[model samples]
Structure formats: C-alpha cells, structure tokens
Target: MSTTTVTSTPNPSVFGQSVTYTATVTGITAGTPPWGDVTFVIAGGPTIGPVTLTQTGVDSGTASVTDSSLAVGSHLVTANFVNSSDPLDNSSGTTIQLVNQAATTTTVTFVPPAPVCGETVTLTAHVAAVPPGSGVPTGTVTFIISADGPTVTGTLDPSGNASVTVPALSVGTHQVAAFYNGDANFAASNSPLTPLAINPASSTTTLTTSPPRRSAVSR
Candidate 1:
C-alpha cells in the first residue's frame, strides 16, 4: 500500500516557470511496483493536468512532480497513480489557493481645467490609463454635461467632447457636470463645468448642433 499527493506550488506562472508539490506514499509491499500513469486534479475551478512518473525502484511509494499554476484560488488537489493492470487507480485530493493581486487601482478625474459658469464651454472627461507608466494614453474617453437643474440641456460632440448650448428657456446660472461613460459604474466630473446665464452673450452664438455624429449634410 503506497500513496502520492501534492498540496501547493509557487505562482506568477510566468512564461517559463515550474511548480512542485510533495507526494507522500507509505507502507508499500517490498516487491510492489511504483505507481504509474500519475495525474493531478487541482480542486478549484481552473485548468486540470496530469503527468507520468518514472519509478526509482520497486516498493518506493513517494515521488514529486512539477506543475504550472493556471489560476489563483482555493483548490482541492488529487494525486492519482495506478499500480495494477486492473485499472482501479489510486488518488488523493486537498485544497489550496493561488492568490493574485493587482498593483494598480482605479482613480477617477475630471477635465476642462475649471468650472466656467454662464457659457458653452467644450469639456472632456479624463481617466488616467493603467500601469501609470507609458506616455501613451488609450481607451475611449466619455463626455457628459448636466445642468444643475432641468433648465438647460447639455450635449456632447463626436469625440465625446461636450459643448453646452444654453437654450432660450433656461435662465440664470446653470451648474454643469461632466462624467465619463466609459463604464456603467464609471462617472465623474471633468472639472466642475457650468453654463453662463442663457441670456445674450451665449445665446448670440446660436445653438449649433451637428445632426448626431454623422447625419445628412446641411447647407
């Protein structure tokens, strides 16, 4: 009677990394053959694998093998070995976790410098990219402008840049806030933006709106 099993491994599973776990097998028949066709079953929801082992000598029930980590989490492991041609295999299982932690956290920010009340200013929301290193920026930036009250309706440009068109009905100072719509749960001020009183100066510019991104050409 012999046994074999593995309980843990080093992770980060880089391109060329290997893991090893102990296999404890005891009380073997003096002439009993070593376990063959050994396999491993990691008891978490992740990839599965198995390997073949070469016996050092007869009746030695202990051996070790290297494995590559597939995921991070608690896992129940099983070590399987076959000693008889009858096909009734030997196996064991245990639990462990592969912990993977991210280094960067998400922080929200706003754009357009500062708030400009009583004016149709162009604004954009900024989300600092990941890794916080490369000078290159990626991902689509969202744009949003909200009037403090229902008085003024704000809109955005093709580039998700927002330009306020203080309509005629809205009077007095309207507070405008821009948010990133990149994700459902993601929204923040691109700096507190405001629309000047929809009186004369702003109204004089004419509420210019291009027909949705790409629409019929207008003369």
Candidate 2:
C-alpha cells in the first residue's frame, strides 16, 4: 500500500512574505515491494520564493519552507517523493502533492467613471470607489451603446471613465447615451425642448412693425 497525501498550500499572509513549510504524510507503504527509502522535495513559486523547499529526507518525509520569505502573489506548490531512498525502484512523478494560493491583488479604485448624458465622460478602472462605505461596483464589465449612443471604448481613465462625445443633437427627447458595462444598465439622456425658440413675430405686429414706409400721401 503506497502512501498518498495532500498538503494545503501556505498563505503568503501579507504581500512579499515567505515562510518555511512542512507537510504531514498521511498513508505510507512502510515496508513493501522494492523498499529502500524515499526522498522529499519542494517545487513551485519563485527562485527566491516558493521555488522549492530546502529540506530533504527519507520516504514519507516533511519538506521545510519559509513562506513569509516570498513576495506577495499567487503560488503553486508541490511535494514530490523521489526514489533516492529506494535504489531498486528508480522513478519520478510517482508520489506528488499539489496546492494553489493567491495573495490577492489590492488597489481599489473606481472603474469606468460614472457615465453621463450628452457629455464626454472618462472612466477609470478599479475594485473600490467612494471608499469604505461609498461607491463600490460589482463584477467585471464592458461598455456599449443603445439609442443615439455616444462613442464608448474599453479605454478607461484613472477613475475608469470611458470617454464618449456627443455632438449637437436634434430637438426632441432621446436616449442620447447607453452604458454597456457588460451589464444592461440603461443610462438615459433625454433632450429637453430647446429652452427659447425664436417666437415668430405676430403677423399682426410684423406689418405695423416694418420700417415706416414713406407715406405715398406725403410724397
């Protein structure tokens, strides 16, 4: 009965911290077919990070590693049992353990600055905005158009505001803009009636208002 085991990957705790590691073997063959000894080794991470543990020993051995000594980021670790201990059985990849972890990217900023109607808007990308208890959006997203939509692109600003420019539009209501954050969030722009229209001079007043005609009677 060969030994099989699974070790949980160590967390980096804070970014850029590595620590020593040791795995607890579960099942072992003890003494069976072609028995001599077993060697353990570490692998993954980076050269100065998880790359591999420095501890080496017989079969069913625990690897030594310092995870805090590694940089903050994602890492994949594996423990392998080499045939060094057993001379009769020469092989690799027979016994191995694997695990994965993420340090978590932290840099919360607002993404795609809030979209506006009929105005050029610039958007930035981020995981947080408004801070603590304020503006915070959810999930991955993209922008688009619906009706009389403005120009939108993937390019985002520091605040993740996509730029959209809308030129002068005709009079009448309109959904001048559409926000396609990958989500169908209908941001609307309604053109209010042009505030002041040239009220045509009343015909009754126009004729009388015209330059006083030299009276033919006076001529």
lDDT of 1 by residue, 120-157 (tens): 43433434322311112223433333444433223333
Q: Pick the candidate with the highest TM-score.
A: 1
Q: Rate the local accuracy (lDDT) of all candidates.
A: 0.42, 0.32
TM-score of 2: 0.31
RMSD of 2: 12.2
Worst 10 residues of 2 by lDDT: 183-192
lDDT of 2 by residue, 1-219 (tens): 334232433332333223444433322354322232323344434322222222233434433444432222344444443334444333322222222222111121222223223333332223223211122223342333334534433433444343333343333333222232321111112111212111222235444456767856753
Best lDDT goes to which candidate?
1
